[model samples]
Target chain A: MKKYNAVFACLLLVLFTNSAAASSSLEEYFYASGKIKVVITVAAIVLIGLFVYLQRLDSRLKKLEKNKIEK
Target chain B: MKLWLKILCAVLLFYALLSSFYHPLAPGGLTVDIEKLVPGANTFVYSGYNTHFKDHSNDGLQFFVSSGSHYYPTEIIEVIDNNHAKVNVVLPDTLPSEEIAFYANTPTDGTVYIMKPMDISAFVFHQNYTNGSVPVKVANDQHQNFGYPFQVIIFESIRNLMWHVPMWFTMFVIMFISFIQSIHVLSATGRENMLDSSMIYVQSGIHDRKASASAETGLIFCILGLITGSIWARFTWGAWWTNDPQLNGAMVVFLMYVAYFILRNSVNDEEKRARLAAIFNIFAFVLLVVLLMVMPRFAEGLHPGKSGNPAFSSYDLDSSLRMVFYPAVFGFILLGYWIYNLRLRIKILESNEEI
Candidate 1:
């Protein structure tokens, strides 16, 4: 349950960080900057999603190992 | 499961990644320095983005003023730089409106046009060259081989179609596979209950596991798709999220799947969870079709294929784009399937108490 809460907090942090970066960069940068920023944001999202997915899989594997040890 | 298929997916995606970045945007759009024009000799400085006007001499460049379908030739005064030019446009006796479109053409850039009508505010200006209707002078229609379409605003962002669109397409394919698996699980359970035996329940559990695994992978792709889409929207539409129908529909579909996961976690019994989730999955699939596909077409939205915007077919993905686009679609779909397959195997191992 604590792990789940931490994951949710991390997700919220990512969401807020993304929105803040998007709004600030648009105001700060010119035309060409927009493209680079967009590419970075997209790549970041994919990497984060994959990371979270792997974390879930790791937790499941841990649970299976715990059950095996108890038996 | 096959090594060769996984290798192929990796190779195709690598090719797509390389090609999307390497290809350059074709030159287009003519920007004018002046906003207003008079009937007599008027000078307007012209420039373009990614244009090859510098390659052409004063003789090679042509300017024209177009009102409706009728075009009147303008005299080119000087070719200052490759990107910039000075034009002496003599106003015609009469224009359709107070504002008229100006166009510039080069052998390499084809025709770069500025459709923002420059206001002809001067009362003394009149076309004295011809008494009758002046025939529109057509510019040279020379095509340059740049290997990509050059739209005005979309410019370089056209490359995102390779990465962003395929994510959604791959997600849809995986979700559809999940939907099919869910149906099989429900039917298998139905058959077993009718026979008054728990034997078929084992088989149905496997199907249920596969279905859930597919949905899990599909959700990952969906999240990636939405994130990429939002980034694209920020640059193109000047907002992270718009009130567009297609965008809203996609969000709703994503939310529906989130609810599915929540529902699955709430139910403790394996058989009951599978049965309930399978029913919900079928309902969600139907809603996905309606929200993402059907409803967007009828309403006005900023997205392509909506009422106001032009669909993908209108632009016509020329041979150049199709070369990379088709491969990207195939690669992403294969990759998605591979991930789902791996997840399903893990689920099977878990249920059997195997490491």
Candidate 2:
């Protein structure tokens, strides 16, 4: 619970400090949209890859059972 | 071919379309001019639409504005042209950090999307303007989320094509299978020989209380089609039930199929039950076509294609949407067939043991 509280406070500080962020030359919001798009694409690729991997494992198990029966 | 594949493809298509909800097909664009558009500032920035001055096309976007945060319809004074307009007195000021909502009624096109629609429900609140630029993103000053990237092609009433239209295809396939099996049974050259008469055939039982696999699959598709259809109605028409002739007729057909099952179970003799149900299936199907397809067009309905409100056959399909909608239909129908085949096998085994 204390750890959670610390994390929450950190989040609050980051949010409140955003207005002050304009002083920095980086202007993080400018890259925000592109960063979001990259995250979405990466997540989608991971999910689709996971689906294929799981499906392959399932079929391989079935094949092993078939081979054992034949032997 | 599989339920998972169909659901995945359909959901992806829905999400893709949902992602670009604001883009429209027409040429003219939307513009919000803040011509001194501050409150108590009567002659505020003007908001309207623009057609390519080249094409002379017009999209309507008319709005009334005032500074006090309260919009009075009395504010709109006159229309100078298709693009520009005047309004009544607006207050020149507002409270600090305050967001005042000014209402714009865009009934026609998206070229004039000054009024932001938050949901399907919010669409009802705005006054109707014709010929406005379709909105790409609903802008809210509260969020500062400007210019949403939604590319929605107006597949109006066609989304119903997914749930309402495909049931017929599934029904037709099941009915066709039933017809073929019936023919096979009749041509088998002998009955009471117990082979032809056996309720033991899973395809369409010969002598037992179990219904054929085809019938169960048919019932599942019919029932699911009915349910999704009613849910689709909630989003499209905002009501669960309407006095649509086609809707009523389809309900009757659905109930008739339910009755088909009950009537199949009530009888004890296998041969009599199979023969009777087969005959009824043929008749019920013919009635289904007449009710779901024929009656709606002639009877006039709230549904599309029937009442001339909208029809897929009448419109050109955008290549993007056709890619998704067509596959979804095929995938779902194929999955329906797989379910039927499974049910048929179960019936055959059950009948075999009755000996």
Candidate topping DockQ: 1
TM-score of 1: 0.85
For B240-331, candidate 2 gives per-residue lDDT tens digits of 57788977987898888887788778988766676777667667877877887778889868765665576543333334545444654664
Could you give the CAPRI-style class of model 1? Answer: acceptable
**lDDT of model 1, residue B308:** 60
Clashing pairs in 1: B54-B82, B92-B127, B93-B127
| Chain B alone, TM-score, model 1 | 0.90
lDDT by residue for model 1 (B1-355), tens: 6999999999998888777777766666647888677666668887776676668774467777665565667777777878777877776555554446777777777776776645555633244423223564454334545345656666667778777888889888999998998999899988974775567778678878988999989999988899889878877888879999888998998999999999999999989999999999999998998988899888889987677677554554445567788898898899889888878877887879842
Model 2 has a DockQ score of 0.03
Query: Alpha carbon lDDT of residue B169, candidate 1?
Result: 90
> lDDT (CA) for every model shown?
0.76, 0.48
